[model samples]
Target: MSGPIPVADYMRLALAQTPQVSDQNKTEINTNEQGYYMKQDVFGQGGDFITSPEITQMFGELLGAWGIQCWKQLRGPSKFNVVELGPGRGTLSRDMLKVFSKFQNVVGNDISLNLVEISPFLSQKQHEVICIPSEKLEQDQKNLSPPSNSYQQGFSKDNGCPVSWYKDIRDVPKEFSLYVAHEFFDALPVHKLQKVDEGWREVLVDIKPDNEKEFRFVISRHETPMLNVLRTRYPKLFETSRNHLEISLDALLILEELTTRLEECGGIAVIIDYGHDGTKEDTFRAFRKHQLHDPLTDPGSADITADVDFSIIKEIFSDKALVCGPVSQQTFLRRLGIDLRLDNLLKAAKTEVEQDQLRSGYKMIVNDMGTRFHCISLFPKVLEKYLGRLKFAGFHE
Candidate 1:
């Protein structure tokens, strides 16, 4: 308590006394850290890192078009919802709304925008972005200010699209909705497990006994129920030496809930994140000021994330949802007409600087590093006929 206290210190103390801290408890550290966005700018050039939507307007535009096509396939409901999880700075939502506004005839005007965001700081930024006109967005960006009531109960833009914010996806009303989760799942907490002699033990954070202020990764004394599930579900993991596995049970639970909602109602979800379909490597990482750091070093000060295991996602929704491509982001965007959109933007560029900015954004999303990121789309089985044999642009070879 005297010197610098690690974010895990309090939890470690609780675990020492009770010795029964659940895996969920370990995940809370990360979630709580993320919820502290009010104290940090974790997005854009001024922050630690940037996302796809931040890289290019074309990214959001393509997704908006894709969503519109899916809406048509779903028979174009009179009233539907457009939801985005963790809509950082509201850039993607703004871009998507622009497309929706342009194609109002087909997309319809009776749509509500729902965002599941917990951070008050980000929610205000989102409100500002979505509520402003496209033409004024650039000019307003400089003079933008956080609303007095950061926790907006309800808001809307001039277009009459009611915008509401929720802390959890479950709170979003059940309806035909289009969902977008961009780099959302990676932020969810993951439980780290390592192969052990007895079985598999969870990796936890604890204060180093010799250096009370320092934290270290310590294995649990006994195997958890989660380990048993992993052993049964993935026996091959044990075959290797020092096998370390990280699984986001929180992410799986969210997907299950989303799948159920999609099946009950009628809609689709597109998930874009930096991860492989599936892998068996420890991907727990932290970023601060755009540089990687030890995740345990600074808890709330750094961004902690792991590569999503999209293979598990496909398996989970295989029956309930029509799971499509865990395809590469590059292929997905290109298939969604990113090239054509880029060319059009370039032709319209008024200056050399404008042209260069557009090119850099295009390259960032389609290059080798960007190609590693993946996009997966999910919809209920009932829409199969409407979708027909037509493969989604990114999902097909």
Candidate 2:
């Protein structure tokens, strides 16, 4: 345990300990037993950071509109899944489902909600907000069958839409699905690699000799598997002038799974996160109480994340799916009619506090998240021509 390990390995070890609410032994997530994400409430004002969905209903509502449009483009399938990766607090799901409810008759009755989440505490939180009370789901939670892929199941409080929970995306039934991965890929573990005179070397985490609690970064002396994979899978990364970069293999694998599913079953995917077009370097960092924190300090105490390299995403989907705008969040939202939504909300505001809240949320999403975050969409390649013929809501200038 004292030996140096790959950064990705360290991340997995740290995140693996995120809280399981059902675990009787661990009551406090801030303790050594907890991990970065599930250790405590890590979203909104009191948590480590805030996400778009938590910021305002509009973020999810816009996404809901996008989803419905996508569903229509797919010819309004009789049965489809709305699979959300990392359904934090289940806020976006709730918002999207509320939108989905209005068109139940058009989209047909076989809509299912599948959430890919691991933290027991967060999953429970998602359930409370997303699902109506169900004794069956409660019993399933208490005595989960070992063989079932879904650990819990229920129906949406607003629409009576069935919802299911799975720890991994593969467990979600392969069907026509509208996928959402807001801020999901960035949280996956990334291996920091440095380009040396001879070849690529990996930056690893090691225990400081003087203090067991402290950790430091060390470069591997020899070539590693990650280096080889990086070279083979994405040679363009090496072409970059930057000497140091972080790559998330988990993210690529998830994209592969998503692309395959879309190819086979027919679907669309939206990925919204803070990232770059493979131009930047050294973005692996942590946050605690809405401030930047040392990732190695208190290992699992803070949320660890890295900026996504969106260029690689484009590369992955190049041949398989039609990759649409990895556009700025501001542009996407504006194109999606966020301004109109804001105006309508402003009109409906009953008090100054309500109006201020709406305005603030709009500023955060449009002015802050707008510029920082990026949005990308994926559709089956068969729709390439069809998509071109139509003006996609968010991609245009």
Candidate 3:
């Protein structure tokens, strides 16, 4: 509040602070935003951004089908988890749960849903869409007790499968879980590093001298702690020709945790995001009302993100698991039969509006998002041979 800070700290402030950055003059400020997410609704046409699931039911349906197929590959475990990280508005989970509901007879009542969400506002929204209040859940909460690991628990409205909420993935029960992280890694805090004459220096945010309300990027005059760690951990990144790039230590740590889970628990993960293969640099930006916005102009007024480096994830996954293709969303979806699903929906359309939506949604996801967004998967290394022979759907080995 009094001095220059890291970009990651600014982001945490922007995302969680209720008062304007101008309120820096105040002695104290509220840490938790008051109904910010409730008012912002930062997804879909009316919000700052829109995800694929918001564009069409097909997106979720296909992912749901993918989950089932993966579970089948897990030998139809007697009990397992379907966990989603950063499920916004629960659209994907809702659609996936619907598909899972149809397979109850085969999967039995052993499937559980666990959502790793940090935002209370979004978590409530997710709960509203994915769960239905029931006497059994209430009884379980009262007569028994909710699991200590979760803040809330319930039953899926679609199939009465047990559903739980966790603030962190580590808190989720250790089970053979299928993890889905759609556009999650990009949102994690990233440290902007620049190659300086001596070494790498961190990019920081400082209040403009003339305008206290405004922020500007400033390079550190001295090496920061993050710079030292990056040098030690990824010395090769410094060897690149590029002078500037962004790296998310948080993202790398999370990927390592996920890989450890898959290696130890026998599970899989599907990660979808718009990212580079360790080639591009300076991709951090913001969006407001579906348009690009200056991230430093008005903090907390927009959604900030950076392109994920899939190469980093691949490296981590490859260490302990069977890393699959970092394929384009187009390739992934087409492999999963999006075209056939679209054709079927088009044939059933009752009006021009429905047909147009179907056609446009298909094109947007396949052509627009399909190219920009990439999908990667991780399976336990034990299945490397089995999966190599058959290949994971939507991802060529």
Q: Candidate 1 local accuracy as lDDT?
A: 0.73
lDDT (CA) per prediction: 0.73, 0.83, 0.81
TM-score of each: 0.83, 0.91, 0.92
Model 1 lDDT-worst window of ten: 13-22
- Give candidates' CA RMSD values in order: 6.9, 4.9, 2.6
Error of 1 at 5 (Å): 15
Which of 2 and 3 is the better model by TM-score?
A: 3
Highest-scoring model, TM-score: 3
Ranking of candidates on lDDT, top first? 2, 3, 1
Q: Over all chains combined, what TM-score does candidate 2 have?
A: 0.91
lDDT of 3 by residue, 1-397 (tens): 5446777666656665633445464212345554234345688998889999999999999998887787786785788589999999999999988887787776677778999988878888888898885553665544645666898777788988778899888898887888999999888878898888977789998767677666688999999888889789866556667788788887777777888888888887999998878888889898899899998766677888899888777654576888887899999999999999999999999999999999999989999889899998888888866754656789862
Candidate 2, 160-214: lDDT as tens digits: 7778899999988888999999999988999999988877899987666666546
Q: Say which prediction, candidate 1 or candidate 3, comes out ahead on TM-score.
A: 3
> What's the true lDDT of residue 19 in model 1?
20
Report residue 264 deviation for candidate 1 (angstroms).
0.6
